[model samples]
Target: MPVFSGIWVALVTPFNEGAIDFPALRRLARHLLDAGVSGLVACGTTGEAAALSKDEQLAVLDALLDEVPGDQLVMGVAGNNLTEVLAFQREVQRRPIAGVLVPAPYYIRPSQDGLLAWFGAIADASTVPVILYDIPYRTGVRLELDTLRQLARHPRVVAIKDCGGNPETTLALIADGELDVLTGEDGQIFNTLCMGGRGAIAASAHIHPQEFVRMADCIANGELAAARVIFQKLQPLIRLAFAEPNPAPVKSLLAMQGLIVDELRLPMQRSSPTLLQRLRAELA
Candidate 1:
């Protein structure tokens, strides 16, 4: 329920010399929780879910489960393979998670009908609530408004991590009020919340999660001016989080805190020296 309506950190999967670091991962989860993040999303794009093998992904989820309650965790499920994705979903259900964060099949562009069919199957099989991940930039396909509205009709499809970047669609979704609209884009968190969004699944919140939590709480309590101040302060870190690419920037800051090792899986690189300097200055 927290992930459905509050600031859930899109966690970075800690790695050590190219291997999954379970102990460090658990430590990071506890760190975020202690900072008051509403919940944690394991294996999201920020967590490099794509780079990890299925077994490793589940292992990461299990490790987090050891540190957080089921209601405070959401498992990210992604893959272009329908059968494999469904099977992974089944495996994920063996544990008690709040919901599954699923995006459209990546790389293979599917028509709206295809998108509908794809989500339909997943939603049908889902025992837990489904949070539709609509990040077209990464998934290479968009979940048009109509497709989302149709999916909203499903009892299981209860929310969306909205990073589609179409404001009109965002507004429509907010107005429709069927599903909880959680912005995945860090920069849009404030605007989206003001537009009646449920909350955010923010990657930048990984740095100062308590502030993000306070910001959301402020907005919810009708303290717009206070919320704006928090958002403004977080704006720099949010911009820098994506300045290079994803968890690299976020991971760099966390590493500086000695939370985890400064590492990332191949095909992804660690933050550059210059960016690290900027990160240090920003945190300073």
Candidate 2:
């Protein structure tokens, strides 16, 4: 299995006039790659996957793949529909991706046994490795430590995007050394890495990606002081990226950089004016 270490950006999908912006998407992927992110995750929560159509999601994945090496790309596979999710997984594996980031079935909130079976089935069908996404806040269910341990034993289940919001689970997973624990929460990146996390799939990395990358390297190289400085400096930016509901705040900042238009699909709106002002000050 490939080591999923360093800073992997949970990329935000770019939009223009309420449609998928392929050109902007391509540029954003190249920008992050050039800035030296370890990898790129497409259609993840940060990308607003819930809002994108199936075709749009695939297009976004293809756009990233065009700029990123297959080994450095992971596509997010989410939804409560098991059959549909599995079918999508089959199609996603056809590409030479690093792996798939699969969250638990949302709204259904399955039991540990169900969680195990759900992920096991996906792993069984996946040609590539599976990175379990344990984000209970969004999915409405937690992958208990024991359940995670069971999943760890699966040969194809390699890593996890640890957003369970429980420090105990995080530490235990690190100590167990069964799965590579990548921090999904941007604010927790430094502590997670210091606690022996493999890396981060950070949405905050969309801006100043090199800093995030450098911080990870510093931590890995035992430069705690340097890493601390970087993390402290980035705290405000990280907080601001998520001040609003996700990509809204993130996309606003990106728009200020002329990277993409400040737009989002309905049901999801743009960042508030106050937040936008703060973003400008922070970027300045």
Candidate 3:
């Protein structure tokens, strides 16, 4: 089995002056690891991977390799164009990364056959396992259940990050018994775990690492009642974080904690005043 089970944070890439902030990132990574995150995804959507330059991406991975303990899982988000993705895989061939997390080609909305071919090609070239990331809302293409099953059979293809955020899909994936389904939606962590899924790739874990851990513990210990309470308490904050575009509210919360300056690259901006007020109230 892949080592991606349990609580893994789709870590936020810290930034300053519109560049990768290494110091803040290192602090955040160490903090999350200490707080009991099972793994760290360095260049995920929460990390604003799209905004980072290629050199910066490599630098982030290098920094992570240096800072993160070998036991902790470290995955790089390398889903992009076929050429770019292949290049990224080649670049990180000798790196210490645990594996790569890839989504279907975004913006292009490729057909299912196209999606299958694309992931197959990447898997063929990858040095380590590849985790399928299926967030149709962002990718504009859903890797269907059938497609996922096909991909799961590949030796190099491992678990999946299921951000579809539907219990039916969660249940079906769990029932299928072939693939490991890690919930990507924070709001669904408790419920997802209840459905017998492995765990979560929660973005909100950056804020409440303990709570997600608590949820996992509660479920494993068969304490659903306690898990329900934490789930309800976290729901509002979850909504707030996703109120605007992602990373905006999350970065704001991180700034309030004095972890990193709230800086974002262009086309992605800070949360609006209304959302900021709500986020502050939650943090307070």
Candidate 4:
């Protein structure tokens, strides 16, 4: 398996006064890498990829490509909008990115067939491999298992970041034996692993990377008892991070650690006082 295996966190983009906070992002990226995360995903849903302008997105990617080690798998989010996506692919072709993370169109809610075509065109256009992102909760569209298997036939489409929240769907895909199923749901990693999935690309790994990576490694190495202990410890934190809109709770935790400003772009505000108190107590 590629080093892309194991926990890859969809990183939160830190900001201050409406500009990307490079210092904060650098600090958090360093923290995550030191904590044993397998890779870093910049500009994913949790990173608020949609809120960023094209240049801002590239700037963020360039900063990460510089700060994060070359060995780390640095994947950037490639949202829908075929024209812009194609442009992004060409633009980044010269950069030092490992792969692209993409999702089905959100507002348009394309049909399964439409999704297959949309991703197919991008995969054909991309110089790098594409990791299909399936988070129906965010996109309002789910790339069904059959459609996914069909897309897997394409050479440029490599792995999947699955947030479908259904192991049955994951199991079916594993049985197809084409694509690698990397769990996006933090709560489902163990079960997904037991069901023959490869690993996870979790948002929660942003805070507790070593523990999460340990749990996956334990299970992979067949140490169920140790894995269960770590999984139980992780549940509370995972629940809180996702208790609100993503990156909000996570950014708050990072802020408390003095990693970033904890400032989110408009439409995504800071966590409520209740959540902050709960998060501190949970961590304590």
Candidate 5:
């Protein structure tokens, strides 16, 4: 099985004066790794990969490769275009990476057969493990349970970042035990872990990563009471992180800590003053 276990931070890309901030990024990556997160996922939604140009994305990946261990890193690979996506994947896999987190083709909303072909081609082509990212809200296409089960048969398809929002399907995947099920929903992290799912690729975990890591470890060790306490403590911050468009509230909090500059590219604005006030109160 793939080593996609424990709390993995869905890292936020730090921006400074409209350029990627390598210094802040390197520091943040080190902080999370030191906090004992299972690993770091670069260029996922939380990292604003969609907002980055392909070259910029590759640059971010390269920076992470230098800062994070190859085996402890996963790069987000997403595109609706098969040929183009494949070419990009080739570039990413050129560097040693633990896995590639892929979602179903967005905007196109491919059928189950289409999804199977899409992921199969990538899995067939990938030298590293392929982690299916089932985020229908963003992709506009939910990866049906049957489709997921079939894809699990692929040798390189080792895990999933499940944001499918279907409890039955989530339960089914856990029961099937085919792929390592990592919840993409921060709130579901605790529930998923308790239900025997492996872990999470959490955007909110970017904040209190040590707590998230501790929660996973506690649960893994059968210390349910201890893990529950950490989960309850995190509930407020988790709720506030997505209170606005993601990475806004998250970046604001990180900036308050001086980890990164409080900046995001156009259209992805900073968190509202009211939201920031709320975050300050919570962090305080």
Candidate 6:
């Protein structure tokens, strides 16, 4: 495994006037790196991967790679089409990424066997390690524990971004210990870490990233009281971040900080006025 531990920010793609804001993206990547996140995940759900064209995604990756080391970057890859996904994987593998974060094929809702085959084939083709993304809610199918356990046998399948929302599954995966369990659910970071999980791929960390990092360190060092206090302070921000559809409230807060313009692609809008008020209050 490539030590996919600690807080890895699921970076939002900053847009400006309907275009990918490369400078802002670079600045944000540098900011997160300066704040001490373990790594950055570009083109993930938080980054609005679905909204970006292949060229735009690669450009974003390029900008981030320029700012952050390749080992400190994980690129998100998802699609219902296996061939296209594999081809995209081949294209991205040319860069020295830490690994590719892959979700099960969306929309089609493949059987466990199909899921195994899908991830296995991608894992086989990928030169870098694979971080299995078990976000069933977005992908429309769960990567069940048994299926995940089966995938663990693959030499290239090294970690999991767990958003399955099942504590039993989370506990099982941690107990199994075959994969490094990094919770994708921001709110679960504290609990997941306490439960013997490795780290987080948090969207909420974008706001006060150092606190998220410190919280994880506290838990890792067995300082539960300190970790609990940090989590309590961060709870409100996490709630507000996801209050709107992801990255909206996140981008809103980031824009307020002047990190990026608060823009998101259409179909995905900016944070609502009500939530913006809350975010402002929270940031204040």
All models, RMSD in angstroms:
1.1, 0.9, 1.6, 1.5, 0.8, 0.8
lDDT of each: 0.93, 0.92, 0.82, 0.83, 0.93, 0.93
Candidate 3 error regions (>4 Å): none
- lDDT string for model 2 (149-188, tens) is 9999998899999999999999999999989999999999
Query: In model 3, where is the ten-residue run with the lowest total lDDT?
Result: 70-79
Judge candidate 1 at residue 284 and give its lDDT.
Answer: 89
- Measured on C-alpha atoms, candidate 3 has an lDDT of 0.82
Supply candidate 3's per-residue lDDT for 136.
91
TM-score between model 6 and native: 0.99
lDDT of 4 by residue, 1-284 (tens): 54247888889999998899998888888889888887888888888887998899888888887778654645565666788778877887668667888888788899998998899998898877788989898789998888998999998888898888767788888788677788888888888877778888888887778999899899989998899899988999999999999889988888887888988988998999999999898767
For 71-98, candidate 6 gives per-residue lDDT tens digits of: 9999999898999999889889999899
**What TM-score would every model get versus the actual structure?**
0.98, 0.98, 0.95, 0.95, 0.98, 0.99
Who is ahead in lDDT, 1 or 2? 1
RMSD of 2: 0.9
- Residue 228 in candidate 6 has what lDDT? 100
* Tens-digit per-residue lDDT, 1-284, candidate 3: 54567898888888888778898988888888888878888788888888887788888888877779644645565655788779877887668667788888889999889989999999999888788899999988888877888988888887789987666666877898767788888777787888888888878888888887887888878999998998888888888888888888999998989999998887889888888788889999
Model 1 misplaced regions, further than 4 Å: 1-3
RMSD of 5: 0.8
TM-score for candidate 3, please give it. 0.95
Off by over 4 Å in 5: none
Q: How close is candidate 5 to the true structure, as a TM-score?
A: 0.98
